[model samples]
Target: MLIISPQTCTEGFAYDRGSRRCIDEDECRTQPDVCRGDMQCVNQNGGYLCLPRRLYDQPYRSEIPARPEATAQCLLGYTPAEDGSCDDIDECETNSHHCNPTQVCINTAGGYTCSCTEGYWLIGGQCQDIDECRYGYCQQLCANVPGSYSCSCNPGFILNPDSRTCQDVDECEDEPCTHGCFNTYGSFMCNCDEGFELASDGTSCIDLDECSFSEFLCQHRCVNTPGSFSCVCPPGYYVYEDGRSCEDINECDTGNNTCTTAQVCFNFQGGNTCLDALQCHSPYVEVSDNQCMCSAENPACRDKPFTILYRHMDLSSGRSVPADIFQMQATTRYPGAFYIFQIKSGNEGREFYMRQTSNVSATLVLSRPIKGPRELVLDLEMVTVNNVINFRGSSIIRLTVFVSEHPF
Candidate 1:
């Protein structure tokens, strides 16, 4: 025998024999008159709703009229209490207000209001974020946050305690520069010491290359140190006390010359030379270390010099014109005597001139500018005449001049 159990259905549901299941009943269609004249029915899965007909026609009304079918009368956002009196509904507590997330909801008598929260403002019926930065809150830099602003400063400045202005940061206190530092309005500057210069990084100091800046700063070579510069001369020279000029070392007087006992050491600008003692030819006698004398009685020395002397001198090139270089004076000054001076030879360039300075002395003057390394041999002759006694004597000096290559 084949038998089937009878199925049971809950309220608002009916058993279907064709599909073998229980289906929900359409209450709105099954009972068209279930609602009142001013109300309509809406079907749900397990129940039905009787809403005002006006709610279907005007869904966005600002004011909702009280329902005549309710036990107590109340406006929108209000509910009836146990005493049958309308009470204010807390839309915020109930989470039923249509306010923005950033707005606050407050309940009133039979209604509710929406307002912007902190850090925001209500504008044109909408909540807007307030720009605190637009109010000039920060002096240097301002960063606008959601509802406020943050104050900042520039690189070399610091924000003040009030957070409205910027103050200069004293980088000098931190010793940012190797030598010195200066603080300005909003920044700091680095400075170097006497002979140093600021580096590219603006925080360090480096040696100033004075030599590279000007070649004439030193006479010979310029040496740069940490904070100073030095003018250096060669092995046989020395620097002037108050300047960068190089002077002759005078190795002969300094006892640094490599000359034998029989040789004489002559010092020049940067070097020394050794020479044999002066040699007197025939008819002449050695009167001094560098002088030779000849007697008037010797016929071979009639036209020749009665006395001959040798002299050596060193000079820097490009000397000033008309400079008094050498002076010749008679050893004995005799009353009523006359003397004359002249350059016998070695004036090919006419670079020298002589002027009588006194009755017994004469001076040799340079007439033109001459550059060297060069050597000039000048034969200067001085003639002395004593007409009262009929005496005439002449002296010759062989002057050898060495001009250095440099002026200093």
Candidate 2:
């Protein structure tokens, strides 16, 4: 209903004289100085605008303005395929991703994402080694390495099949000790048997040396044996039933003495002796086992001894010196009788001496060491003087001594 001239165009159209019509104007390109600072111009259907420079080139999104049934060209992180379609770019294969060297890159729809590998964590846009020990990865010990971790156990323990737990080691199974062995939670111990002790090396057993600990363990002497001790007794003594004490053995009662038929056997402490049977001399007659008297019918007997006695003794070799061997006592006490005693003979070595203990008693003592396999006959004389009665008499004792060859 209305006719318009070419010169009367609309607000966004321009008059073209050659075509004889109006056309849309490109204000963005024609007006080069339209946009201000930090802004860029965008052309629209009927106008244009100045927008922020950053909003102009958005990645993975359409850069052109929306239009009816129109598609935009490919932006960054995308590739134009041969089928005229846009495809996701594989930055990982092309090594174009910004992920760290220690990180893994995953391809997404339009971009690639960065992630940490095992034993590592993403921190501040970087892959850091994770401390597995802080999380109790191993039961006893833990060690973390690059991109991996390790599990271990402490000493004296072995790792279990799972490689995370530990079990105690049984060291006693190897029999490390000589005598005995004991196993504990994480170690072993060594022990010794009775009458033995553990050595300094902790694996050997040594004798206890029981004899050195106490002297009373044996009655007479102590003999040390391996793993045990024994008691020993001296000669003429035997071990009692208790196995620790000694008892004197009577050689005379056991008929173990070496006395002949002409002698009589007598027993003393630790030894035996033999005495000659009673026999009268030419001027004397036997009265008893140990006494003798002179016959008055013989006139020569008046100057001789009134009586003679005989005795015998046995001694051991290497006997301690100054030993009291015999004691002599008067059979009958007399009033106002002064007595003098002396060794008349058989003391060539001066080994013996007589000590007068009282008016009626005397003792025989040995003063020096005397060895055996020898015999000695001693004549001991006692002279009695009665001062009040004016009478004097003498008696003699013939003593025979046998010394043995051995000490015990």
Candidate 3:
């Protein structure tokens, strides 16, 4: 019904040069630029058709034309494949993940997942070591290991079967110390015995100098040695039974003095002294080197009885001494008792008189006088009025009788 030139036909239609009429035109073959970039052009009767291109696969949409000066890019976490489709990246397996070595990696939608392994936890996106010891799991200390935890004990302790408790070890069994060995967990120590001390080496023993201090024990001097000391006395003294005490030597009894024959050596504490021996004068007779009696002056002195000697018997080294040594004070040891004193034996029986009474103390008294120097021996005993067995204490006494000076 209408005749139109090729240029006058609607878009995508062409004028048939042979029929002299308007007709469909293959615009897709003739003008490739006529369709949109994201669409394909198809030939139709008297026109052309445009359709969207097929998408490659998932994560990819239908073809979309990019704006000016912009490129077509896939969404975040997706990349283009060989077929121009978008595919999610497996960062977990592709070595593109940010997970720590101690963490586990998992692929997620559009991203990756990171999780910490055992004995570790996430902190600031990184796996941090877990401190199991902080929770009191171990008695002393704890350490973190890969995928697990470990327990430890302090020095001088040993881990128990539970791995959480600690126990002390016995180092003394091996005698590591010279005297005593103390064992602590993970360590051992040594100690010295009595009178000794630890050395600078920490394990050896050394002697202790006890005399270094100001404790003076010796009578004259103190001699110090390893772990012990001794007391020393002067030349005239000797060490007593007790190691630290000193006693004097009896020079007279031991015959160690320098006295002449005419000099008599008398013993005293700490030393000895000599005295001159006297000779009897006229009208006086020499009883011995040390004494004389005036038997010639009185002439009746020999007629005097020996009973007079007990009155002034001497118990001292000096002649004509008093008899105070024969006296004793009896103390009452029992609750109720009487003290009695008597002579048990004598050189001449009944020659001396002794009195016994129900008193706490008694003594033998000499009321008579002697004509010359004499020696007397006696034994005494003490008893309770009830006759209970009580041994008499023992002591020695020397006695002498002297006629008055020149028998005055």
lDDT values for all models? 0.78, 0.76, 0.58
User: What is candidate 3's CA lDDT for residue 129?
Assistant: 66
Better of 1 and 3 by lDDT: 1
Tens-digit lDDT string for candidate 3 (269-300): 45565756666554555555544555523655
The sequence of per-residue lDDT tens digits that candidate 2 reaches over residues 1-408 is 111356444455566766765566778888887898888787643346576676555544465664655554665568766554568899999999887888798776556667666566555666777666666768998887876668887777899999888999988888999989998877888999888999999889999888999988876788888788888887877888988787667898998889998888876546677767777877788888887888656797887777788887777767898999988767765799988888989999999999999988788899987887467899888888898988788888988887765443
The number of clashing residue pairs in each candidate reads: 0, 0, 5
Clash tally for model 2: 0
lDDT of 1 by residue, 1-408 (tens): 111122434456566677755566789999869998998686754346676777544423224554555456555556776655567788888888777776677664434566655555555556677665665667989998886568999898988889879988887888877888899887889888888878889988888888888998998899987788899987767889956988788889989888999999988887778979989999999999999999888898888898889999988789888899998988977777899999999999999999999888999999998897899999999988999888888889999998887775
| Global local distance difference test of model 1 | 0.78
Consecutive 10-residue window with the lowest summed lDDT within model 2: 1-10
Query: Lowest summed lDDT over 10 consecutive residues: which window, candidate 3?
Result: 304-313
Candidate 3's TM-score: 0.39
Query: Highest lDDT: which candidate?
Result: 1
Candidate 1 vs 2: which has more TM-score: 1
